[model samples]
Target: MDLVNSFLNFVVPPASLLMLAFSWPTLSFINVCEWIYDTYFREIDMDNKVAVITGASSGIGEQIAYEYAKRGANLVLVARRDTRLRGIAENARRLGSRNVLIMAADVVKEDDCRRFITEAINFYGRVDHLVNTASLGHTFFFEEATDPSVFPILLDINFWGNIYPTYVALPYLRQTKGRIVVNASVENWLPLPRMSLYAAAKAALINFYETLRFEVKDNVGITIATHGWIGTEMARGRFMVEEGAEMQWKEEREVHVTGGPVEEFAKLIVDGACRGNAYVKYPSWYDVFFVFRVFAPNILYWTLQMLSTNHVVRRTSYIGTGRPLYLEGSPPRKFLTAGPSTQVPVQQQLKME
Candidate 1:
């Protein structure tokens, strides 16, 4: 592994630079032409199309369902919450969906995922799009993690959760020449502090789908949605904090959080997916970091470490239940100590991804 790392470290820089130097102009030109052609000559008609969207009960998933419904798509909405699914299905129908089916199944379970896909196919006869939006997030220091199993559990939900439904839906997607839309995060490449496991899972998801795209090229379209922090239950979910030797969930109390509106972000994702675009990066500002990480990783590392320190300082006390708690307030109260607080101002932020 050391040898492999050393080789990668030695070869990656020049290879990256060469690729950028060699491919940028041609790729940019091709993209321009494609955009012009698509803008003038083509549009994806979602009317009467079938779309299976996991995590559709709330947040971005919920908004995506609304967008598709307004465009006249039939939808199969999947989530663990039966009540929420039923509510969203009603909203989808009101928004102009021809048909809306709700499946209350956890995406992490293979049997549940298989059943959901089978039911979707049985109901719709064909599926034109599969949106793998199911995901999990965690925020805690890796070394201080209380349970060793937390990491694998995170992977099982975030990585494998997306994979299972895609596998079950692939045959139907192939038959329809359908598209796959995956909601992966920017943390996949960024690896922010207090989010190591979440980053690992998303990184795996991005790479897995990228490989799948190449393997199934031209047969099926795949859109990898690389989103930054968006307003969502998953984003505002409690973060784990290290207290002495143990980890505990903390109530996040920061205001003026840096993220886009979920509805707009969802619309962008759906638009990109419908166009068969390869990637959809929201806010677009995050692309700067993606490029910065590639070219100046050491600098990005130091910056993230600084942000993590601020995060630890600003965090409040623990609330054990892993549940959603939304609190509205001014900035967090400062510590009573003499030294300067590691907490940065609201403008300079520490965010969850």
Candidate 2:
């Protein structure tokens, strides 16, 4: 066994490289052909189709609802905040959605997920698209967690939240030959700072859907989107903080958000789902870092560590002096005031840290 293992290990790396080298051009050409087909020849007509979106109260989910609305899709918006959902539903109607239904439910709970999916079926008769956008983010470093017991909220919301709805709606989706759109994140693979739990949950979510896609085959379409930061509440620091941990204003906003506007990202997501694209990436440039993470992981790690250390040193919120320290021009509040609706210039919004 040891001799066989040694021989295979010695041969596999060069063999894999040779295969990739020979296949690269063919793969690229095939991808381009697929892109052209998806772009021009294919489109799932969403007119009057029932589309259920979890986490539709705000952020990318809200924008996605509008995109679907423009295509005349009937919308079922689900969220915990009823008041916010009402406002979103109104805007979705104004955007051209023929019929909009709002449901207030927690995505993490199986009962809530089942109830919403059932109600959506009863109302619309069939679900054409099940968009899972319910996710929770955390800002504090994993080691800084004072109460580790609260950590499961991140996984529960970010991972199981998406899974529950997908499970409950899969049968109806299969009946309609519908699609499942997942709003995953680039952190699924990127080893970003202060997002240990969130990253792990997203990684699990991505892997689960990838496996499910194979099992379901062409019966149910799945579009998994992985993008970087947008101008969402999460980007504004409305993340899950560890209990007993102080909320500090970190000027690391730029470090976290380096993607395009949520509106643009949402448009692309809906279009890709309608076209049955397997993956959708916003800003697209983030794809470059995957190569770094794969071929030069040490370099990626060192660079990330350096960036995190620099931000930590310049953190303006609290410096362990017992009391909070607010630097000049920094807000004292824990959460930033940038709402998801606040539009910034596209060029400035896409600027990297």
Candidate 3:
């Protein structure tokens, strides 16, 4: 009894509050890591506005930029990949954006965020939408995982990467009454096998976003795009590189409902912004489950656990069978062509035979 009480005392909110009081201002700044947290912190609408997207090279970030551009919004695209950023900027311009600026920088650094915000103000003359879409994912069994070093990198991109840009952009977002859209994963809501750390980080994002929604309800709109299954490039690469090297092409792609293509997913987000909704989910069935979680979390949790193990390869790749998986551009088929010398190309083999 004493031990349990002591443990609770150490971990309880009061203890945490005490620790925070003595700490620097850094802890509080974490709330802005992802869009969900910034919802409460900003005041803005998204239409015909300046939208800032982190990780704007590909996947959800690129999609968001395209969405805004089509709506005739100006853009500031931020990412580490200069080539991809330039491509997206050009596309944004073609898609009817008045102006597009690309910034190549890692969002985890405070200075980078400051630079991004400064550039946004200069390019668009104002700020509106701040979308936190940069994230990283890894595959390894918890028991087999052996990288204490990788955690910081993951948190930097996943947590701090989400926060820093939003922090620097908040004052601008507040002034413009712009919306903050966070691209948090559904794994944050439904924790699954082998992705414990990623899921936990997402859950923190969701919690922060939800609370922020309450705080900012009377102010600007805050939209949290808590997503599952949209077939982004990162998810596709992870699928193709399952277990590092093996490309198990025979499997059924480890998806429940088919994840939409990039353009389709982006449209849904545009619609969500139009509706002024707070929390949105993709592949709508999963959204239903997120709602069900409110009433019976245990039931919801087990149902997902059961659904995870039902896989095409019976869990052969990485993480177990029932774990959440994303599909790629489909399987690769081999062509055989044989030669007389038996040094036949697969295509040549087929032709000769």
Using TM-score as the measure, which candidate wins?
2
**Regions of candidate 2 where Cα sits further than 4 Å from its true position:** 238-258, 311-353
What's the CA error at residue 44 for candidate 1, in Å?
2.2
Which whole-number lDDT from 0 to 100 does residue 94 have in model 3? 91
Candidate 3 regions exceeding 4 Å error are 1-48, 238-258, 291-298, 309-353
The lowest-lDDT stretch of 10 consecutive residues in candidate 1 is: 316-325
Candidates ranked by lDDT: 2, 1, 3
Q: Please, what are the lDDT tens digits per residue for candidate 1 over residues 139-205?
A: 5456544346445666787888889888888888899999999998888887676677788888889
Candidate 1 matches the true fold with a TM-score of 0.78
Model 3's C-alpha root-mean-square deviation from the true structure amounts to 12.2
TM per candidate comes to: 0.78, 0.82, 0.68
**For model 2, what is the alpha-carbon lDDT of residue 1?**
100
lDDT of each: 0.74, 0.77, 0.65
Error of 3 at 304 (Å): 3.8
Evaluated at residue 78, the lDDT of candidate 2 is: 93
lDDT of 3 by residue, 49-149 (tens): 78888888877788888888878888889887687688789888999898888898878889989998998898678987788888776544455433344
Q: Which window of 10 residues has the lowest lDDT sum in candidate 2?
A: 344-353
TM-score of 3: 0.68
